[model samples]
Target chain A: MRFTILFSISLLLTGSRGFAQQRFVLEQSSISFHSDGVIEDIAATNTNVSSIFDASKGEIAYLLNMKDFQFPKKLMQVHFNEKYVESEKYPRASFEGKIVGFDPAVEGLQQVNAVGRMTIHGVTKDVQFPGTVERKGGMLAMKANFILKLQDYAIKVPQIVWQNIAQQVEVTVDFNYRAQ
Target chain B: MMRRILPFVFLLPLLAHAQGDLLDELNKTKPGTDYTIATFKGTRLVNGHTIETKQAGTLEFIFAHRFGPLDGGVYEMFGLDEAFVRLGLDYGITDNLSVSIGRNSADKIMDSYVKYKALSQRSGQKSFPFTLTALGGVAYSISPRRDDEPEGFETVDRLAYTGQLLLARKFSPRLSLQLMPTFIHKNAVSKTVERNDHVALGVGGRLKLTRSVALTTEYYYRLDPPDNDVLEAQTLSPRYNSLGFGIDIETGGHVFQLVLTNTTSLTERTFITQTQGDFFDGKIHLGFNVTRTFQLKKQERR
Candidate 1:
């Protein structure tokens, strides 16, 4: 009877340990967006990103500072943060989602789906996109490409420069995470 | 023994699920700092200065024009027939420091100034209620000295200096206000004036009417009015405080301003102490200014 209790306690401890060890922290990440306007092309990239992945529960989260995005033109950068994003009022954009088929024990690259809520410019909306998760050398790398509608987030573009901005924007995220 | 082990096994996955609240953990690590932006679109608020400054490594080109008094009627084509132009360039040496140079056609005066931001309004760890900036400038008249001036006038007599302390606050996303305490000193005055030093207080505000448009107004009150006796004896016209009202429109890389003002001079030294036109008498000139910015620094690839 004593041996049975000891064996169960050991199993419980190992189970909790395995779950805790599955948490991963992002080592490097990049987020970029592109929009094709009638009069011009708008593009920006933000490399300062923070994110976490939990393979044990198929959970992931990402946070990006809006002011950190770099544009080819300084004035455009100012307009993006001031007029479009209103970064002062809404400083950060974030996402919280679950990987459809994430497994810590799985090896190699696996295509998966992510479904969650994305918050930007003080507005939140449901989003779903296809992604890939690669597990190699005891680390996980995630890459995703998606499209977002500016109107959905309540980002208003005035009629004066209507042709200078696009209705839809393409966003791509790449993150490589290591065990916490 | 089986009962105890069964309960522990059931709680294991629940505990693992709770551990997946990674977002909460990330939130805790994020620095709590928020800095306000776009307090005002440009550095100038009509005829007065604001606390706004250019970002590091940026260059701005400005073209300003003011026409004759609108009261001139159709003969003057509603003030469009005669134009006084000021062309300027400003460069940001650092995020908080900038330098500008301009030449005004009204007096054929060359102007240069250096501006430094002393404090910025923000919340969280570093919180301040208002922004503060220091501005100092000099204007040198390129026009020949008047023959009516007293003898022994040197070249330095054509120089004037200006200093101002600007305080501003972004009260809301749509409203911003500023106060300017200004001082101007002229090396030589027209013999009638008793003193060359002039002090003034200026107030300015901006109200956003739309996402890309704002209504701006400013007024400067002279504290030390020129000697009335000297003014009436030697001057044909009387001087009044400067007043301006305008609208600002912003595009991607450009800002355009349309204004009406009683002052034809573009620099602080001339406008603060030498405004002879009065708005109440319909002596206001129609004006507009265009500003374009360029990024001079190359961004590093990460």
Candidate 2:
């Protein structure tokens, strides 16, 4: 009886292998900035991502890219296509990090702290993010908000009109990515 | 007469194309052909507005063709319909520079000037795509005074110069705004300590109602404040410059404007000298502009 019970426990543990890995993606997103007596609104898509759990190393990795950012205006649309932003030269901003103290063995929802390095506008900064992780039907969800400075990315503000513009800007991100 | 024969010559080609229904085809395309200027059509108020008071006052009628540039029609009776008609085109030679010649009947004066667009619009920025425009003008008055006329009379033949800075921003697809800060210098100095060189501040705005319609209003304030010294012999009060307002409706290529203003002079110099419009008294002028464009084609050797 003891031998049969031990064999059944091994089958249950092996059956759950590779099922704890969770992936989440950003579906649709928008960002707004109001500063220095002016307002600038931006919309983003397909450049944000995060992984709650890593099956191979037992580590969660979070990632994002910025080159996919797009600002909308009929006239500006044409300018962005030909001038500045130069989507061809610089394409994306990305972040990669691991969620600390996450347990793959847990089946329900788990909250954890994720630390990662995010690269944007050709500048990378080490970032710490708070995230909630869930393991249900083999899926994971994550979200975070942070601040970024233009100077950090080598973005220059000209002196002629610097007094009217701001140097620092805030960025917020929320994503629900599904695994293929 | 070239004018009499020109009609038949131009009509012959149209007659052949329409197979004899020339009038019908002309009517069908008339509206579209009239209102096709590149930039937006500004609001031109025709209901006795300030700009129309002075046959030479420069109202916001540039959007509509004003009596075909350079022809200061008889006593501006043509301008009783459009008081101040400033032609914005060219003068002999210049780059990015445009010149204007206008006449104001209310003040009995003639005026002319030039303007240049200094800075073009840039990316990642809002507001006027261009900056730094300079204008210098001269005004000549027709009526000085008669020796036998009444005493205590004030007739100033003032030559004036005006400089204005125009800043515009397209905030959105449906809304655009412009601010015009101007300074006027009159040749005949004001005797009163309060009215120096007729220094005044002016601002104009345009609100687009649709692709072809907009509401426009312009205000001018005598910053120096009026002096208490009044000429006892004059019949009407001598007010500096007054306010002007109007609505512009564009159909096809033609623009129709209804205006209300207390100032009759269209040019800055004339407007400074004579602005007799009073909205309270219902003394506004109403007018419309019908612009016909002719596309001259280069003839090729047969």
Candidate 3:
């Protein structure tokens, strides 16, 4: 009976330790987008990005508050939130993805492909992008850049201001994560 | 007994893995709160002020025009031939404080005012049901006194002051309502029986017709009605409270309002207390206001 209890306790401890090794929390993250239109170039950045990764399972997810995006022009920011993005109705944009061939034990940088579903403006679509992940000094740094078509997300631009906004928006994300 | 013990031990890690779902954990973190935006698209809804204000470090240039009463018919080109123009600039000193200056052609009046936001409605961690703002203004009549006056009017007599408490709430995504209690003080009255102090209550609402267009209406009721016996004895028309309805259309950086109102003046002191046209008498003027905003300062990085 004593040997059975000791074996069970060891199994519980190892299981919890292994689970802890799989999860990582984002310590710092930034997501930015840029668009070139006929009239001008528009860009904005959001630093308040939250993300988590399970290295063993090769799973990752990100959450970004739409209102956190800041534009150089205050009026443009208002229009982005009120007219274009309608952030009040959909406050957050998110992504859930699996990183191909992810390994936490690897010590150096590795380029990989990510397959994901991104949700914006209450619309979701499957997407694939290339990214780089580097493991150094017990930390993980991930970076990705991709292009998004606004129409695919059901975001409509009125005819009057059509020339002021580009149909394709370039998005970039960078995250530095620490083991949980 | 050994088989049962081994199965229970294996299930423990599976349970831990299920609990470790990253997306589920992200969702569990408190969601960032969202505040209502564009409660009213423009600063003014019809004849009264709306709760909307410019963001900090932004400036708005406004051009407003009011035409003659529609009763003039085709002879006056349906009131389009005669026009009163008002040019104004509003600057946001801070997110919650703003100042504005305007010049109106009706009385050739120059007006300046300050607006302060006391409270804002929000949801989530800190929630408020309504937004409250306070506004104060003074207008100077630049027009010369009437030639028939027995004595020359003093400069102090040409000054008018107005104070208003504006309360608003966004009841839904497409509807917002506001209540304004106003006070006006004029140093001199046009008629002998007219008092220098007046109080009024104003109600306004905006209903979204589409994503880019909204319908707005406002009405002011005089709490202390003026008793102008001397003016009435001279066959002069009695003053009526201002009433207006309008539509707001928002483009990229501009908001345009097309309005029909019973008052020809754009300043609160004149429109709320000194309106001469009666709505029931078909004495309504057609007007339009255009606002263009510019960002004067670059946003600092966080």
Top lDDT: which candidate number? 3
Arrange candidates, best lDDT first.
Answer: 3, 1, 2
lDDT of 3 by residue, B83-120 (tens): 99899999999878999999999989999989988889
Off by over 4 Å in 3: A1-20, B1-16, B145-152, B228-230
Instruction: Find the candidate with the highest TM-score and give its number.
Output: 3
Model 2 lDDT, residue B302, Cα: 19
Deviation in angstroms for B190 in model 1? Answer: 3.3
Model 1, span B209-268: residue lDDT tens: 986899999999999788666676885567889999999999877889899999888899
Each prediction's whole-model lDDT (CA): 0.85, 0.45, 0.87
Q: Pick the candidate with the highest DockQ.
A: 3
| Ten-residue stretch with the least lDDT total in model 2 chain B | B48-57
Report model 2's TM-score to 2 decimal places. 0.41
* 2 or 3, greater by DockQ: 3
Off by over 4 Å in 1: A1-21, A159-162, B1-19, B145-150, B191-194
TM-score of chain A of each: 0.88, 0.59, 0.90
For candidate 3 chain B, which ten residues in a row score worst on lDDT?
B143-152
Report residue A104 deviation for candidate 2 (angstroms): 53
Candidate 3 residue pairs in backbone clash: none
